[model samples]
Target: EDQVTQSPEALRLQEGESSSLNCSYTVSGLRGLFWYRQDPGKGPEFLFTLYSAGEEKEKERLKATLTKKESFLHITAPKPEDSATYLCAVQAVRVQGAQKLVFGQGTRLTINP
Candidate 1:
């Protein structure tokens, strides 16, 4: 079965501290890997879409990279506003001409001043 696992479930950091969140996945016929950031009581906001290995994307203080088996969300100099739950999802090709997303539990990051 295809699944995604995120490590360190939660992280608490002082403002300006940098960290990396891990998203490991295994799937058949991978179509794309997705990254999202979710705030409390709100839907996830799309961050990146990785179509192949060796692909990387960046937005402000956040950078996402993908390899064959896993993806990483690297946060640099995060501020209190950066606190959120980071989610990883995978889209795999299906036999029925459809695609489904498998999501990781998410890593909750708290940045305090």
Candidate 2:
């Protein structure tokens, strides 16, 4: 079965604090590892697309990396606006050449100023 799981259902960080969220997944054949940030009541915004182990992607204050069985979303020097639900989704090779992504429950993060 293909599934994705996230840890620490929620996290609280002070302005400038750093932390990491974990995402574990099991899939038949991994086509891509995706990271997204979602604000309340809004759709997820794409962050990274990792296709192989040891690969890393980064934005202004966010970094994402993937491995064979897991992925990590690392936030550095976070700001108040950076607070959101960090969602990790996995896309695998599916029938009919469709890439179906299974998303994790997400790690809700809060940053206080």
Candidate 3:
């Protein structure tokens, strides 16, 4: 069985406020973890890929870190334009060719000036 859930359906933040996004998951076997950012009506843009528990990736004002049971996406000094839906996509190579991706509900973030 594999499942993923994200918290704080939405978030409001000051332009520079820092916060962390959480994704909790359960799976039969670990394959890979993925993070993506999506605006209102566009396809997701890949952010990071975590292959193991102790791995991490970062870019600009965002950072993604992963563990065995969960992953966190941290935002630092965000700006108004950073407001968007953050999505977490996962995949299990163990499943072979059954499904290519699994997606979370997404966390909507708003940065206020």
Best by lDDT: 1
RMSD of each: 0.9, 1.0, 1.2
Q: What is the lDDT of residue 35 in candidate 3?
A: 90
Q: Write the per-residue lDDT of candidate 2 for residues 25-90, one digit (tens) a residue.
A: 999989899998899999999989999999999999999988899999999999999989999999
| Model 2 residue 71 lDDT score | 94
**Candidate 2 similarity to native, TM-score:** 0.95
Candidate 1: segments with Cα more than 4 A from true spot: none
Q: Note the clash tally of each candidate.
A: 0, 0, 0
Model 3, 26-54: lDDT tens digits are: 87676788899999989899989898998
lDDT of each: 0.94, 0.93, 0.89
lDDT of 1 at 61: 99
Model 3 stretches astray by more than 4 angstroms: none
Ranking of models by lDDT: 1, 2, 3
TM-scores for candidates 1 onward, in order: 0.96, 0.95, 0.94
Candidate 2 residue runs with Cα over 4 Å from true position: 95-97
Judge candidate 2 at residue 46 and give its lDDT. 91
Evaluation by lDDT, superior candidate among 1 and 3: 1
- Which has the better TM-score: candidate 1, or candidate 3? 1
